[model samples]
Target: MSKKTLLSEIKEKIDQLVNAGFNNPTQIAKRIHRDLSIDETERTINHTRGTVKYHIHQSKKRKSNPALAQACQERGINFDNVGIAWNKDKHWSIQFRPSETGPTFEEMLQDHIDAIKNHNFKYEKIRRQNYSLPCLLVIDPADIHVGKLASSFETGEDYNTQIAVQRVKEGVDGILQKASGFNIEKIVFVAGNDILHIDTPKRVTTSGTPQDTDGMWYDNFLIAKRLYVDILDKLVKIADVHVMYNPSNHDYTNGFFLADAIKSWYRTCKNISFDVSIAHRKYFKYGTSLIGTTHGDGAKQQDLPLLMAQESKKMWSDTKHRYVYIHHIHHKVSKDYHGVTVEALRSPSSADSWHHRNGYQHSPKAIEGFVHSKDNGQIARFTHLF
Candidate 1:
């Protein structure tokens, strides 16, 4: 690229950053580092800061450089990707790119305001036969916490057994509504770990202190099994179902329990298919795509991607793309790592005051959703349902 062209590109990137709502120099520096893979040395960091300052200074001056000024006027750049690197307090850096990739900040902001509108518009545009494809519904009924008293930690308002069941049923209904709207032909029900309150037969507090329950552990198990069966039967009526029972920290025996029940149930009901296993494991074919799911309790949060990568390498070497969907965090996080997409699905429960007390919050209300594979199974897109 010529010097003039290069300067124009950099100027456009800076302008984009400013327009994307990034004003801090440190943020701009980080974006540059990510986009260009620039070294984070003092010199390079200082250079990025100086570049942003100079551009702003020039724009304020209304300089005679017509090319630079014109590039700034176009202002087609998006700065949401811009980021900053900080060291302690004194040192800082900025990074940004010249063009928009993925969704722009403004687009995302607007999406939050009118998700249904945006979704409808996009759906209408792509509703033609050529784009119509069979969608898969991945249902995750996570952390039921049966037999536990619902306190402030679980919900903003105190919930008795009846209220909790009602809330769960509402979530299930919402999921079914969303799935019906989509052209979904199959359902992957991932029964998350912690299907019960206590991990073992012993009663316990939320913090795992020893306690007692009114009924036997077997009673709790039966209650959980009955509820799950009811939910599965309802879903099977809507679509062909494949249930994956993942054992969790609270209910270490849930996987085995679900597996046995499903095995016996399948003998009686020929329509609903079933696949059950322990959590934190390998991939399975959902359609033409390979999907890996877990309850997300085995490894540290930061190490999950590495664990999934190693597992996917061995289990899905032939697959074009690999996805690992996890529950437990009760928040949504989608990121690409080591040629695999890792997604943390949000929970449908309103009871999560512990998260609120810790100062964590996000919009559209935390929901349960599914990952739809696209690009001939090379990419996965998460669509929030409930």
Candidate 2:
């Protein structure tokens, strides 16, 4: 058998010491000196700790990564069983592994980004005359949860992508019907109150937590964007549409993607505007009312009214009525504080098995909307029950 290289032997000793719990650099250096008789400088060891660990992790990962394993095999070495030890003596001993594995998720995402920039995908929004109305209609498709599956056998209700889509459409129609007598000039459509049931392709939230979902994440994403675009397109004919994105706990990353997709869809349209900023608290001024929207999953309820006032002081001073809209609780609750009304909007989503089993059963299945007048602030509230 060929004798082990000096760097390999050093790396092996370090790994043994590390596995034996010699974590601190001082401790590791002492152990190396004792075991291998190598005068490894303490400061050098300290600096090298991160690199060593990273290489060790990479080595472990390479085993599971078929291409990496195959490349190491071709080199008469196993990257899985041995970590790469870099020093002044050698650099880039190995780069990519050779195998027939497909492109990574990151590679696919980058390709998609490149495609967007090159206009391989077409996006266009209509620009219409600024037909202002006396009142601004606000809808909270809040907690829409587009790809959630709930069987009546479990939750006493049946829900899926189709039901979620239909409910939002019907609820908005109901709100329009109720406001038929009012002259509305603009609409504010707040997206991303858990608009997606999960954030990842693996049916999980942004934090890598799993969720019960109705369909694949891509399917859900398309379904969500389709619903938002459909509703906004319908409303644009009657009034100018102001779109706001409020990222939530469930789909932080993908929700932003969905929001941006909607913005891109209406990018060129004059009748539609967007607040696609990834702000936790977004403020919009319509007529005499100053309105703020958030996901409600973060921050204390009491702090929000004050936050709204402090964050949008100029708007607060200019408007007679101040209100904050919140979602995530999936039910309506209102509180008045220091001249502001902070209210949580209701959602039309039926309870999934988790919610049903947990006794989160009393929330009314409905969607809510608000009417803000040019001078009087919120004049009416519309609720469409499931």
| Candidate 2 local lDDT, 100-199, one digit each (tens) | 2233445335433532453433324445455455788998878989888899887888999999999999999998898877887788988888999887
Reference-based lDDT, each prediction: 0.57, 0.77
lDDT of model 1 at position 377? 58
Candidate 1 Cα deviation (angstroms), residue 204 = 2.4
Which parts of model 1 are misplaced by more than 4 Å? 1-132, 152-155, 205-208, 211-216, 301-306, 309-315, 349-367, 371-386
Error of 1 at 153 (Å): 11
On the 0 to 100 scale, the lDDT of residue 17 in model 1 is: 88
